[model samples]
Target: MRYSIEEMQDAYDEINRKERPLVAFGGALGGALPAAALYFLFAQIGGIFLPMLLMPAAVIGIFARYTGFPYRLKPRIPIGILAMVFHFAGCWLLQLNPFVYLLGPVCAGVAISVSKVKLSRVQEFAIGRAEIGKLGPNKSIQPTAKASAD
Candidate 1:
């Protein structure tokens, strides 16, 4: 049975509301772990530039995952700005090279732009599952195979 758009939307909204807290925690943890590892690894090896190159990428990738693809400027701009602020602050505290300060916004922009190009299949599957769960199973319906052309 087909469900109305409103029904589907409500289901999605409900799911999002319920998952928001968990998603936020997961995003933060996911972003932080790799970044911390990279920072420590680079610090031990005396490689400052490598962490500058990779840390932002890790954080931005996790941010993109939680925020969804097809990034809109209105929503993402503030986030990008916030990330830049944090990056600059961290750099200042750590006494890192000033040149690397620019990497944060650049990485944020690239990640946001690339994310807009395509939605991941996993996201599509999750959305489909949510909709189907809302609509309930139709046991009466049976799958059928189409005849192949010889």
Candidate 2:
């Protein structure tokens, strides 16, 4: 079936506003965690650029949310790869321990790699799932036509 302009817009919007708990988790691990962990572990020495990994993670997160999909290594290939180098360099360059800053890109990438996100109720509705209404108005199973319409 063809999609109306409004429906198409809705779909685009849904894609634009997809869930991204992974990015949040990644950010926590890549940005805040490494900074705290490295600083703590090395007693405030500049560790690898572990925190830099959070940049890609953040980018991936925001992009994933926009596109309604998980991070793609192929699409973000260069940056994704460079993230690793940055992490390593941040540690050595900054004189921070590589192990301590291990929470950088690697952790963020892994975190984003395996995150699951559920669509919003509005999205479910737009995708043809019927709203049962507030306070559970109707929960009964109906005829195929009605069910199919929804």
Candidate 3:
């Protein structure tokens, strides 16, 4: 199962080209939808809690799905940042609690961080065109025992 560097690069480029747009659009939608939902939820409920911390992470998860579990961090960074920025912008628009607004960056940071970890785990086990496609641009790759041994 030896892959030449060129082959690896080809796979990376192929995956990136296919994934970048999907991840960007999906991440944007993910961020915007939740922000709007949370805004309305807060407007109706009028309370905030730690569970909100999950929003950005969820946004990142959506973004990661489109990322196709690339082997590098460079691709994941932008999607995470975009999710945060969109989340913050939506919060600002909805006039959410100042505390929630303040938490936007922090939440985004946590989401992005978690995405990195997931990406690493996925890349370790993702091999071959079939596996990569199955992993898809928007799915997370889980590390199998074979990956751990490597």
Candidate 4:
């Protein structure tokens, strides 16, 4: 029932190896679309508040799916950068306050980090269950009946 260190390492490596480029694409698209929408809608919509609130939500939701999926940072960095660039571009096109540029990336970063933590915990739980399965059922404990005196 015992697994060697090498076996555990192999399992960990296998779990980390399943990387997909689609995650980066999805994350980038998630951030860009909302920013584009914000830029186009700013003047016509007549209010900054709604777009501001909705855009980050859209980015976070989109990027959330790809987090904690065993991908390397190389792909993810670009996705975040692309999203930030789009957000900055949107801000530039709208000529909104300068501070808005920092807001989007910061919010996105926090959301992504939180999502990664949550998902990683789920992965850990799954791994624990699998390890438990390898140990088989518990047989050491059995129910015992006490004789009653008549």
lDDT of each: 0.50, 0.44, 0.55, 0.53
Model 4 TM-score, all chains together: 0.51
TM-score per candidate, chains pooled:
0.46, 0.32, 0.51, 0.51
Sort by TM-score, best first: 4, 3, 1, 2
Model 2 regions more than 4 Å off: 1-9, 12-80, 110-119, 124-150
Global CA lDDT computed for model 2: 0.44
Question: lDDT of candidate 1?
Answer: 0.50
- What lDDT score is found at residue 134 in candidate 1? 35
Top candidate by TM-score: 4
Query: Candidate 1 clashing pairs?
Result: none
- Greater-TM-score candidate between 1 and 2: 1
Candidate 1 RMSD to the correct structure: 10.5
Choose the strongest candidate by lDDT.
Answer: 3
Q: Which pairs clash in the backbone of model 4?
A: none
Total backbone collisions for each predicted model: 0, 7, 5, 0
Descending-lDDT candidate ranking: 3, 4, 1, 2
All-Cα superposition RMSD per candidate: 10.5, 11.5, 11.0, 11.0
In the range 73-106, model 4's lDDT, one tens digit per residue, is 4445545555556666666777877877666666
